[model samples]
Target: MTAADTFETILEMRARAVEDLLGSLLDERILPGEIARPARLLQAMRHGVLNGGKRLRPFLVVESAGLFGADQDAALRVAAALECVHCYSLIHDDLPAMDDDDLRRGQPTVHKAYDEATAILAGDSLLTLAFDILADEATAIAADRRAALVLALARAAGAGGMAGGQALDLDAERTQPDEAGIITLQAMKTGALIRFACEAGAIVAGAPAADRERLAEFGSAIGLAFQLADDLLDLTSDTTTLGKTAGKDVAAGKATLVQLHGPDWTRRQLDGLVLQARELLKPYGAAASTLKLAANFVATRRK
Candidate 1:
């Protein structure tokens, strides 16, 4: 098979693996410390997360760790934890108070499938579960590795990261931010977790700090590409194609790079970002091939 085909194959395999792990994690079985797993809350959480997407963040974790010959099982657990955090963000992002969307991944959003309160709790539970997974001995990583993972994820998901970025996004609706403001907001809101996804793999592998930094920079480049592609899709794609409300960005008057610089310019910028990402991974040679393709995938994704 071709390299692109290999990338797709690996991506699909990793996504399926994550899906199964998440399914098991969200199952009705209660762990030792938990008194009970509320049925409705679990159902809401599953609804928000179980609905299909690319599972790209988890895939990144697996792939990045693989580059360093890290333990696959440990990497998978880390990937799953990162996915929990991502799905939680999505659940809350679709809330009535946030994007107010009714759909996600072609399914009713958590708040739509369940009550608003249930959705909120579901998001909260998943967010908490992420750290739990990271800290749990079941993950089988060393203590320091686990601690590093926890700290990185906390920073990526906390007020200084994704949540803070969301707040800025909400504010942007009222007062449009400048180009620099938009970049910062996008980096925190969208790029932060992605950066962690890549860095987490290196951390799990106990790779050198320099290698971790390289992967993080690669992630930042592709994260920008991902957001740019998403913005372009919002402008050009339909709801059926996007699997969610399309043109909502325009309707909300949200500022994006695509809006700031026309689609043609945005497309060129995406190319440049992908090139930058690939260059960052060049030192790793062919081991970085999958990641290079990932950068292309992020830049060119339709949804």
Candidate 2:
């Protein structure tokens, strides 16, 4: 296959793998009659997770694993774990006290779909289940490796990473943040998990220190680029195309790159970030094509 074709194929396969794993987890772990009488609760959890989304976090985990010669089977579990954490964050972020949005991935938010209490529990369950999946002996990675992966994921999802960034974002809403402040907020809130995705893949594959560092850089650059693109999309795209409430950032008074820099300038910045990420992967040779394409895709994605 041509390089572009190969990258497209990899993205398709990765998307399918993520959807399958997420569906299975929802069916077996979330909905299997463990809860009492609230079918809507399980449905809300599944809806929040299984709805059509890019699944970029899991894709990063799988692609980075390929860089380090890890088999797909070995990487699948880690990918699933990453998605769990991501979904849980989204669920909580959509709560009444948080973003208070009614839509996610073109569907009703978990709280809107079910109730506030159920949504809270569902988010909590997904977060804990992420660690459970990592610790599962049957599909579990080596103990030391699992420990490292768990640590990486926890740190990314916790106060030092996504949550901390979110807190910063909330604080930034009431006031106009400078460019540097906006970047710092985005880096912590969104970039941390994206960085963790790549790092976790490398860790699962037992990558050397140098390769791991390179992948981490690649992830960080792409993560920031992804947020910039999101900011741009919020300004440019409509709700029908975006599958959620567009222009919500402006309504929420969120300080985004697009707010600091105009759309034209923000687009240029995204291009620079994507180019830098690709350069970081040059040493990986042909094996890095997928990463390069993924970076481009993230920068150019419309929704």
Q: Could you give candidate 1's per-residue lDDT for residues 11-85 as a string of tens digits?
A: 999999999999999999999999999888998988888887789999999999999999999999999999999
- Residue-level lDDT for 230 in candidate 1: 95
lDDT of each: 0.92, 0.84
Model 1 regions more than 4 Å off: none
Q: Candidate 2: misplaced stretches above 4 Å? A: 1-9, 29-43
Backbone collision count in every prediction? 0, 0
* Candidate 2 lowest-lDDT run of ten: 28-37
**Poorest lDDT segment (10 consecutive residues) of candidate 1:** 98-107
Which digits, one per residue and each the tens of the lDDT, describe model 2 over residues 1-303?
866677667787888888898787677443343455355666767877887666788899998898888867768888988888889899999998987888775678888878899999889878887887777664456788888888888988899889998898888867677888887888899999999988888898888888888888899999999998998999999988987778988888777778776899998898899889999989889887888999998898877
lDDT of 1 at 267: 94
